[model samples]
Target: MERMEHTSNADLRAAADTVLARLVGDVSGTARLREDQWRAIEALVADRRRALVVQRTGWGKSAVYFVATSLLRAQGSGPTVIVSPLLALMRNQVEAAARAGIHARTINSSNTEEWEDVQDEIAAGAVDVLLVSPERLNNPDFRDQVLPRLAAATGLLVVDEAHCISDWGHDFRPDYRRLRTMLADLPPGVPVLATTATANARVTADVAEQLGTGGSSDALVLRGPLDRDSLSLGVLRLSDAAHRMAWLAEHLDELPGSGIIYTLTVAAAEEVTAFLRQRGHTVASYTGKTENADRQQAEEDLLANKVKALVATSALGMGFDKPDLGFVVHLGSPSSPIAYYQQVGRAGRGVEHAEVLLLPGKEDEAIWEYFASLAFPSEELVRRTLDILAHAEKPLSLPALEPLVELRRSRLESMLKVLDVDGAVKRVKGGWIATGQPWTYDAERYAWVARQRKAEQRAMREYASTTDCRMEFLQRQLDDEAAKPCGRCDNCAGPRFTADMSEEALDAARVDLGRAGVDVEPRRMWPTGLPAIGVDLKGRLPAGEQAAPGRALGRLSDIGWGNRLRPMLAAQAPDGPVPDDVAKAVVGVLADWAKGPGGWAGGVQDPQPRPVGVVIVASRTRPQLIHSLGARIAEVGRLPLLGAVEYTGEVYPGPRSNSAQRLKALDGALTVPPALASALAEAQGPVLLVDDYTETGWTLAVAARMLRRSGAQGVLPLVLAVQG
Candidate 1:
């Protein structure tokens, strides 16, 4: 360390003072920490206990973890271990730490020898912080070789994205289950500092439980609001893949500096990138299959301004932070809103106003449903796993244990990790050993109950399918209320959404549907034979001429039951009664109400039939119709249901995903009987029918089919907040 002259110390002190004051500031501006951040810092200062932070993207989360490392250095030399899921993120934080004058090191495959050398500093207690991936932290060699060293060198255990410990965390990296073991191996008194950008109340509780964060978790665990005003929220009624691609092409020049386009599939990433490049845009593609060296180069070019945009997936998360990013576009529906926020957060890092465009594809929701399907754990499977854990004398190897567990090879692998999080077993060596404990029904059962997660899946689908303000959902996720509409998004700017579409549009015209959480008006009521529009199935979005036989509807059929709500031409009506295959799947739901999709004839006193919330993109409604719907809702309904209704008749040029208008419409149309509202608050049922217009009927068909889950009984009852 260089000795400082009086002048140098004073200058350094002045800079330090600015940081110190900002550390505890009340309202954090863009690129700055808010009172929530300062509160977290203050809590860390107070007897430093375990802290789990659930914040939204762009809330200056990195600054919180970085400041903690700063504190360690200020108190004199002490090592800090940060277990990150993303290699890029780990690398970035390591570089950031170095820049901040903190000695930071990382153990990753990028530099094997250099990684080995880090052990020396750690062993000598000279390294101030060590960034690692859990895959490394969980390795026997690393645990054996470096953990003892960690005990001597570190002052705190900093687990970034602590929410990963919970299955519900935005991006679940199954390996996160072993965090407790990582914590156990650390020095005895090192407090756990857990932080994440996406985690709700249940997630926070789950984090505390998994990390063994007790009061000894000491009070450092904090939750920050997931709010950002710099982002303009937009949603639109997109026609087809060609239109989406065209829109993307049109918006290329709108992006400044670096931008990332998120795709639901690997193929989509390549296609979008190639299309953009052909259109004369400086674009690159990054995905799991991308070579590591190539990916790094792509990242460098993006940051160095050699490339204007990159087409990627969640693969871009963790360590890739180019503070000057212009925007993040989703070429298809994201798996979850949390994922959407994380992906979009990559943009506006410098707190610059940014656009988050989500161009939904027909198959987007189905793609995720297939992946998220693995979320549910079976009782038979659970028992088989417990048996294996009970029998294993040593850590079981995958090859060795595969025969004993009756599950897909992949399922068993993931389940064992989830079991580990429940503390049902411990993974050791190539196998896992029993924890020598009796398991309670709730603990073992709820741990794998995937039905409780169905609504979350709905929320994700809603984000993509609903023509409402995308930002409001993001803010609400963080417990922040959206008071007004954000003007910059597609829904707000879309043309058809103007006040003159119809009488209901006039009533609901005051609110921006994008910001409304309610579902928009149904497209089914259009007079017979609306002109049929066509799209190229092979074509991408926002491109190609608009014409064909309700072609977009064919694509919509691919997204599951949610697709039925998509905008369609008045000329195109179902040639026959909509299919009942999906309805048969949930016949109990259709039997309850006589009204066209959402009539509640079942009374509140009746056992909660699976509840379904219908979000309708409605046109104008007479006051009499609104009162009629309210009166019907007040009657005990077979299914406890709520409708998010909107009245914006014609869609604008933007994605009509804004729900503000619909929410208002629903509020005006549906007044809960005080008793019905209370009953809904306490209602327990599966998410039975989440649907709107069903011409092809595939979207609703699929949703009705998925309502049989055991945990599906817990979907939160939907409520209409306002009228359009």
Candidate 2:
């Protein structure tokens, strides 16, 4: 203990070496700190100054923080507080800390039961390092009651994945911006360390500026080249999603080692995982929707090399540490090159050669656009949100406030966090309350953010098409000062992977993709606060008034039949008769629907009757398609073609807004003609309600209600596609 105290103020290099030896155990006998790692440790421990370290994934950024924490604690400083963004990261850090003879603990969403014990450890000075997620910084109980004490006593502050602290970053989180308050309140001498593997010049500058204690000049920034020698980057332009899947099915075993297969959506992740399983590959699906216990199991499986891969979304990103991951493959391109770089960096961390492949698809841009729409809300919407809270009599939780605001639930939560950072609102025991503080909406800043996102999207497209070195392209995108062409990537050294799949594999993939039929579950409950929107409906719809579980030929976002259905249902497609092939596919779907697990053949005591008649929903844009489909279905089934439900009001033009607004627009838009009502009154069984596509399902719900009121036994929705 005496020797450790003496070494704290001695030569900083010697102290860092001592700590590094403890950090790496016997490995440190042959290992030495990189010059920049030593510099960051010195800045934090010796100089007691803030620093930001931007290096590639395997560059020992964690060593800088762990070494600094050891030095500070040896001198009797308080515990280090690490603000990490992911649970997987925190768990890995805790385990890593234990190897250095440091006692570490974490408080996060996953372990509320342990929080009290953790707090007791902190109070007892038994915890050497403490890690908490960024969201925990804004949690009402932690922020109001515990954060102040932790901030003042923190020996060192480390922000992992610090790119998230800047809005300029591709994956920014509003919760991270709340760190400004924590940074401001920290005791004067507590040093700060921020680290990330992915950040361009703009994001680095933004984060460095935020790290400023008294002035911007106080923060030292250390950035290095973003090249990963172990990763051989390549891009394969697939004809469509099915081709991408076929390529994977044909070549997955050829990849080097156990690794990750990334998909852009949870559904795609699950679909790909299922397909690979069918192909006899061991894989698991990981996504935001994955259960916590399952996520832990998946991570464990990947680390143990039990599964060949985990088909995952970005939820498996950042903070997952595996030293020898073999490869990374993307089913579709991400919207930003920086984000793609971060994900691929997860690979080749502790190996000689790991493959990185991107299979760009045509639907990638549309998916990008859909996500881009969820950026910070407009000033009008933000202002309206605050007004609602201000006028409320009590704190309002997210779901309780969701209907009052037109923004979606996720977007609304993000906006509330931003407002919390701006001091316009506060999250309390029950929910959020207006702080009654004046705030200004930064219109220029938001516009600049939007423009930045658009630029990133464009850069991603260039990345997919560029004829240059893929590694160099990614390095340059991150503004790496020493960016250079690697001699290993596909472009720099010619193609290392072939874009060929066996005809047998292609046939199997085609059959898989061609197999279609997605159950469209009826909207069971009405959106809450419908009365506020001037709709008489509220709560769950009665069983008699609801549409039965319906069927769509395919999901508009699916990788399968969606490719064929998209153009046909697109707004610009000219209305025409149902094509023969699509008609045949629909018939196949109906046949399977009658026998599938969730359908009438599921062995229910009471079976559903077959459709006795067909009713076409009025369509202004695709009248020819709807009428043709209804007529063809009736002809095929030998059923009566009931008169079409006529549009009694102005055309709805199909939901361009939220659910409430959509319902309002289509409230009285359709009515059953007297002939149709009379025919329905005479029908002995269910009738088929046909439309080109269903977006919100509110139209089907409303139409079904009318049919049921007209004495039809039941209404079954049959549509070409369902939009997600």
Candidate 3:
């Protein structure tokens, strides 16, 4: 690489002009690069130095990499490798690269079939930029077969949404840590760039240190003020979820242009989207659960202005580009101000002014706490996972390992990636293998990370209730030295929105939210490798023993009744009798459940007999709630109240383990009392099994099986709330 001092200023100026012209056509016009953008481009292309650019959204961060790639490719360098985080963002980057006459391609989860073709293009020197997801870096085949060649031949490397590489980042992804290995493998003088709009001083330092680009002081860090001049921020404290949904239905069209409405959960997004559509708004729902095809269509529709807005979760955040987005409304507050600022930055990129509002709900903090529980695993769990893999005779796939370990599938996958990066495990063609490398759990580091999360949560609460300027508060949270009141927020200016909702709208929202019942489909097959846990069950369960399809009053994660049931079912809440309203709601669900297609009245090939009696499942935690709910249902339906199923063993509660372990714990925990067996023997129809809450549904399945064997015609599992 040539030193910057040796290059003449005239040549550098001429090269920058050409790159700018490619970036924006008709360069003869006032289409020149900002000083910071030029500096970043010079560092990466001419000086051959690593750079970290922490500019706000729409500050031309992407332009620096695209232009640099164009210049580098002209000099016969290999294709630029960009690590992006979202599919929507990748699509937009591909299109933007095309406008500059650069050939770009992406290899992500959605396009595995195209990986071979992309590799061919790269080898043939026909590709200028190649985009990939962070998760792909840890994939066994890609890591072993493709990463080495790409790293050795890459011209420029870019990490978009680079904040995720830091543990202190609001959205940390373990897979991003794999970059450490890639960075080390790169040849000398290969320029690297990382860009994010949401990182504060701490996150910036952390990411820069991880980049390890000739040490932190040598790496060029260009961080600008974290403020969007076009966004007018505000917060409205809504009474509850219903009021929030009603407000959106009432005021969605009053905002500037088509934009995004972000929700904290997928269920809330779907509910809000449905309610808005009922009120005559053309919108779509976007979440992690959405299929790839549908997500693509939703993005295209939003970009084309075919819809008014997209009701989405954080799944739609980061890298989505739409210059003319008009507004951003949060149905619920995010856990961190950095995350909030990132989502709100999506608006007012091209336009002069846009609306950004946060409708804080009472349940927001609870939702935040629930997500906080999914952080990195404990030392014991990690050790257990490693021990399992080490003792196995052969490599263990994720499912096979799930039975031996207690972590859920998603969390387990994330932990494995972290271990793989730490050299404790290796992912091969068959499965994961223990490397037997000595590793120490970083207790102090994890504790610090936990404390940081709590502080971020506190900052978010402050952001919601602060009387200061919203933008200034958010900027200060990111450690922006230039933080100052924007003079446009609700605090600086007067209130921009009102909480007053008409009775008709409120009534409509209540009806929509109150109409609750979610089908709880029974588990039809036993988890694989059950015999390894000393359980006899395996393969498909017999049809005769399967529980009938069940119903729940609502999901614990829903936007409507969830708010009502969460507190009552909270781990800390005192156990008591079922509330009158909830009991009434259960009756409503039963009434609707009886009329559905597969209900007792439905004309099916095998019609189920109506439940003749009600049986309560004994609960150690919420015995009163379960017993009261069952007794009320029996009283209302005029049915016999059968004796309760006794929990004969120690109070195992419910599934805190994987399927195999949970089934093992619940195999013979329940027993039919003599009176209950006698009552079931004389029953003429199916019986309803009641419980307080259902999480894994293994408890319900076991109890239903016991009831069926005791001579009940069939068993119907009913619960107050179902875990999402």
Candidate 4:
């Protein structure tokens, strides 16, 4: 039962081969090692006892473990261990290593019967190397079933997607933090090697820190040439959704061979796949929803050239390797430019001049905003969770946490997982143990926090409607480089680059409406009758001056100010006050009738006479108003500042009460003329028709041309306010 040992690298490799022969008899596999990979392999074998390999995704990272284990087995060192994110990946690595004539096995949740066998093999040093998902390693059964048995077990912990260890890294996993705990429980001197597809220098350094391995710079950092001369990358923004699909259709026929059309949703993937197939393109749909058998079939079909393209969700790329893929067509705006670039990277894997076309349209932002709003946890749920975790005596299981909290199962799980990563909870053998719970919120404080959480949700919603470059906007807020536009993003592709609020941009020849770069003759938001150094919205009537500096915005609260434009602040009059003449007439009649009570004719002084104008500037809103309103000057009796009033409060006059419902029956002399839309229609150049919301964009489309913008113009309407 004694294990043999060898001091020399050659002897170790020879012994490793003999050990592998015991399991996978003396087979040899291809060793097409890149120069850098070969160098890392040498460093792995030449080392005294332990080695680490940190490499990119496709650089054959799994090879380091397989090849090194071969050399180590020859040295008479026991089994090597690898832990990673996916079950399929572990299985693939283990199978490939076996085919290479090295004994390898995988233990994970997916395989029930073989799991015990694999663990048993690792225990007896029957397997040269063992592969398992991180979950399997974290199992307490690991210590009981296997760890104590291998006398020469050289534990080689390989973490795939290694960037997850750092909070600042692109991908962070709560389970990753617990990895340090797992490592500590292992025998000392075990080398942990972590690898990922994409990570920056900061993330790279953190990987080493998280692993607690002061392993030598012999700690490998190998990035094969980014000089993917075969890949031709290009960013594109389309004319519209229809046009974008047209481009896809044209390209499918025009391209060379296998392709990937990555859509933003499962619905999109299915729809596109069906549409393309109907058009005789031989397409296949592959998404997370697709069954396992179907997914593998789709992948195989694409690889065999039976399918021209695989229409898949974001889930598809990381799961499989389709090397000969010819092009990658992006179907929508990605959450970040980084994601866009990474998804596009799937193409041109095996050939020269592989094309990646980005398809972006205006509606993509709505999709993105919807996606962004999905991040917040319900406030009530988070509050209850903090309370539950705070008082916990032991690790809380999903079943226990569910009944103790008042939230949907999925959201609570995610928040608890996040709390775990934040060091608030530690995962134990059974469930989770709280570490530093902050659950002492009073009722009022919880209410206040809830309000703030809701506000933050609104802020994130508003962020999507921002007129800034989408990439630069996200980068600035998230990465602290807000204005640093990724030239590859749609905003950078906009006709105008400087979309910020600079005095220069205010007077620039062209201003980016950001998403909408329409060719508006030039106009600023202005109330009527204001010329004080203000420029009238260009392409409008001669006197259309810009909005005044001191002018305030108002909203319509009540139907008192009949046919009058509402501003943000209180109106000069609230109740409908009668004009002097109308008041005099009513008073005179009442006085005559009251001269003799009998002459009153049961009228009793005309019931306090209604105000002359029921002009209601609707103002009933939560909290106090922000500013005051003043005399709104009018152009042809049209108040351009009227749109600003819509911001004061949400208008739900009634679901059935359309904009013009029962207007003629109102007892008012002023007719609500539709002159404003007409005036906007006549404006030349590019004109930005301001509105708070653009649900159907009927308002924008109706007012489109008068804004002097065409469907084909270099500009489009810029809508601001809360996202729709």
Candidate 5:
């Protein structure tokens, strides 16, 4: 087989056209590559060049790579290695490749059992394309052994969702920077292609520079207008979550076809799913918590249109393709307009018209702030981490480091990935180790990045409230030179959606959101490596000391009551008596608990005992609120109000991100007062232990242990909200 580099331009064009028709399932020569698509392919295959393609969604970005892989493999090129970002995207690409007679195999978190077989196929030249996730690029064995061989033999390199390679991109991942090394190691003359639909000018320039690695400093960048004529974009602003949900219930059926309903958090997704199901709508919840098999099933259900919509989070954003997906409805605004664009772009791909709507919520900003707090740790935290690793005797796994650090597991791993890329640390077989490299914190750059995020958030707010063309607003956000009004949008053609909801729908939504009580599952096991932090605790907590399964009025992430509960539990909110409505809601929750499954009414094997008293957990920030809730419940249930458990020590000053650190701070801070102990001894029945809210549940666990040990029959914990 000869290299196509010397092929005539006309011959290259004709060959690409044949592959394009086959890829699109049009065998009668009715389908051809767009001029820009052909140019991208020609540059990659004929000229052996690196190229960055910034095209709109549904603009045949995948086609460019599939067609190029077909042409390159025919010329005896090694199997094309694509560094894809999402499992969904990889699955879609694999199927699409097979349609063009390209044997594509994926190695992702979901397909570990098939990795060796896939590798064997690649080695035997039976596989024409191999798709690996960005995270896979950093796996110890894969990085140390497999990547080098794959790089040397690769004919073409493709980075799907390439915007993620840029720090400026909306969905940047630290693992993406590892691509620079992969690109640098590629054999000379290996053509590379990067594609995304959501990059702006800044992200585009950054990605182009990244693609220029390994001496290809003049990478070709092909960007196109981002306007989508098939989309009818609109924003329907209602008063609160209930109204927005009511609007959804009233209008979901009216949307063009089967599609997605995006929520900001997993709790919201599940809540929406449950409520929509109760209303007889065919919907399923898809989130990070969903099992892999369930996610796959949900995706299949959506593709087959077995369900009307999938209530999902950003977890379902990338790699999903349903050509006839008729709509995409966002229940809450995403923090960045760029991310919103990528999500809404899922619709209107193959159809003449599709509906895209945003039902922005007031709780959206709070959710945004919560995620923002998890960004790159401060310089102090990073320095401390480096010092700990510098003095370590061996590679430390993430759990081993958790007790020594203040960051959560996800944030900590993400930081390690960045540090690994920055040469300050290295990920080895066991875990992470310090490289002893001279590393300076990029304070200025991080500050600029923070500012950029805030600006993007503000832009998203404007997008929701702006009177201008919605499509044009998104286009300009991507820095498209051809941004213009799409006359199909609600703004351009006048409002196509009404904010008004039927009274019946509104009442039903209120009933759903108004009903409270999410189970507060007890923490069964203590965090790992607690001894490293001077704590002797480890392994599963004793059943005798564990609190009975508790209940919260709602979650801070709940779409129904989150808006009402968030403020009442906020650190800055004025602490006062529990409002009458809230007090009544608590009573209702108790009544339901007394009668629901596993309640004291004897529905389960061993039903809980009715509370003989109410006990308050001391709250430094909201003692009045806690006391009021306990007193109200005690009065309503005709039970005694036991004395409050008191705080005996100063506030434990530590980051509250992970369970271990949280437990460490709470270890000795709480104590059962003598009066409370006496009251508990006399009560002789399960007591309703109360608090304003529970975040980690460790505090509740600690308090419940003290109560149970002090002779309380059992601790039935209740709280205003669950922050997890």
Candidate 6:
């Protein structure tokens, strides 16, 4: 450590205590920093050294930075710049700094209107700290214009959630990798600090190595036990989704003060939220789909204990601070123990004890596979993207590039960011441009990452089934040297919760799960730059030719019907007649659709007219399934069976393709045969357009337009499953 003889150790300790008291708002004057916290702060403030503190949540990681900022500012240093990952964390840190009479400002996507003013304040030395998201670090204007100036002047640099910088970490983000550029630009003697509640030995080593970049000395590493004394962990293995839902509805009220209930998917989150609310609990759903304003309100409500709980997906994880959060229950297991540890750490932070439970389901693996497919694209795709950017006359926006590549928009953007960090591509004013740098595709490294992911999945499985202490198992996974049986968990102390639930709750859960039918809204507008791909589609879809809002039996991401639909819809599944149970469920969906709000018989502003006939879309993979379903619906609804729309082109590309490519492959794929045209021309009202599945919704849209142009008055789409 770099030592300074100008100040005595005793005097430095006294100053640190005074700052802690102000930061914590401790009027009692008894607040003092722990020995390790003091060591970390002293290294940054007095020794001017980089440090990585791997401590558990609520271990006062923020306090170390804030106290150091206070001491540094007193010596006439520039403001501390925190590269935080989440908005919630930044807000909490800003509030905590205010208690110490420190002026803090934030620049993020939500406050773009105020960036100019915040920048002015920083220039005038009016702010003590400035928080920015990791994404902001690589934004073209910020990186090329504002970043160098800020780095040259920064007093102290803090990387919150530093694990994200490591490729091995559970939450690795490409944007965090851009920090290396700023790190290299920092003026001499600018101390740096990286902090996280999660990160195993490998991740720790990786982050520490990065911290040493552009510096002459290595970072001082301080790691502690990854155990929470207030957490009583356990696992409850149930038969199926119904049992799990029943258990939650019965025991939600029994969980200590208000807390969070996590789901694996947005659909599942919404489903759980609705089920709990129906069970007389005041709960709201929080997911990536939630509006920004609503997300803020939900956070505030949870902070003030206004709601019973928030049923959420992984989007609610990281940087969400609730000192007294009572419990955290996962409806399904996360793929990694490191990730689960970070999430459960949110609880038991400020309380004497809190409940932690995992209700693992058989379907969790399917969800894991779905997410795994979205990992880094193959080498071929990456090379194609680079080649396109290299030869382009000018910068190409994401939309303009979409038609040229087969990857989804979000995945494409993420790949570009990683390329930018590696110096192969540059994001400019209009879009992205190639830098002509020689880049090698590291096949070995990518393969190792894939293997590591599988290993984590296996570890999570072992975590759920192990008979040993749950806390010890998790600690060991994190490579904590202090791993040991906590003696406070359910396995160590015997069960504190019963597997048995009230029969009434089970029956209610069944009824709710048995309810079918979800809205499959029609795609109204064409994807941008479609004309560039040789297809003429552009702008809003003609209203008269579009299909009416549609309905489906369930989402493949749901806990109820999803369980039944997944296996039947698998690509490897046999193409046989529809199963008896699924046929009944389809009938149930139609029945519910007719009577529910917006249905043919329900009260609404503009109810859809009852269907006149049924038309089936030919499916190469599930021809029998589609034919049987369409015939059954026609028989039950007492409507004639309109002829099918024949497939007259190359084999379908399936659901894995992106919007532009899917539309291109489907442009001249299907045709309306003469018999189908005649039947549609004779139909009196809207037709029930049936398909086995809908992923991108392009197939249905195109087919609906064909039927409408041929002669059907209106079309209402029905599908077995809606892929997210």
Candidate 1 lDDT over 1-724, as tens digits, reads 2222323433433434345444434234223345676566545533456667766666666666666556645655367778888777876776776655667888876667887578777767667778878777556666666666665566777778777777656666667776766667666556567877776666777788888774352555566556566666555445555556655666567655568888776655766676667667888999888998899899989888898888887788766888778877787777666667777777786755776666667656556655665664667768876886686666767655654544445667777666666667766666677786665545553554355356666787776655666566665654443324455555555532211123332222122111112222222221111121111122121111111111011122222222332322112333322233322322332333322233335444434343443222222322332333333333334333443223233432121112221222222232223443344344444342222233322222222222222123322222122111
How does candidate 6 fare on TM-score? 0.97
* N/CA/C clash count, model 3: 0
Candidate 2 lDDT score relative to the true structure? 0.87
Assess each prediction's global lDDT (C-alpha) against the native.
0.54, 0.87, 0.88, 0.47, 0.89, 0.90
Taking the tens digit of each residue's C-alpha lDDT, what string does model 5 give over 1-724?
2345557878888988988887888969778888999999998988889988888899999999888888898788898999988888888888888778888998888889999998898889898889999999999999999999999999999999998987777898999999989888998899999999999998888888877832355568888999888899999889988898888887899998899999999999988898889888999999999998999999999999999999999999888999999999999999998999999999999999999999999999999998888789999999999999999999999999988998889999999999999999999999999999999999998888899999999999999999999999999888889988899888999988888788998899899999888899988899999999988899998898889998999988887778898877776799899999999998999898988887887557578888899889877777788888899999999999998878876764333888999988877878899888998888889898898888888888888989999988899999989995
TM-score for each of the candidates? 0.61, 0.95, 0.97, 0.55, 0.98, 0.97
Q: Which RMSD values do the candidates have, in order?
A: 19.7, 2.2, 2.2, 20.1, 1.6, 2.2
> Considering every candidate listed, which one attains the maximal lDDT?
6
Quote model 4's TM-score.
0.55
Pull out the clashing pairs in model 3.
none
What candidate 4 gets wrong by more than 4 Å, as runs, is 1-32, 48-57, 135-154, 213-220, 223-225, 373-383, 390-408, 421-423, 426-724
- Comparing candidate 3 with candidate 4, which one achieves the higher TM-score? 3
TM-score of structure candidate 1: 0.61
Stretches of candidate 1 above 4 Å error? 1-38, 109-112, 182-189, 212-218, 385-396, 403-410, 421-425, 430-449, 464-469, 481-724
Q: What is the lDDT of candidate 4?
A: 0.47
Count of residue pairs whose backbone atoms collide, per candidate: 101, 0, 0, 48, 1, 0
Q: Where is the poorest 10-residue window by lDDT in model 2?
A: 1-10
Lowest-sum lDDT 10-residue window in model 3: 1-10
Q: Give the residue spans of candidate 2 off by over 4 A.
A: 1-12, 25-28, 598-606, 645-647, 651-653, 656-661
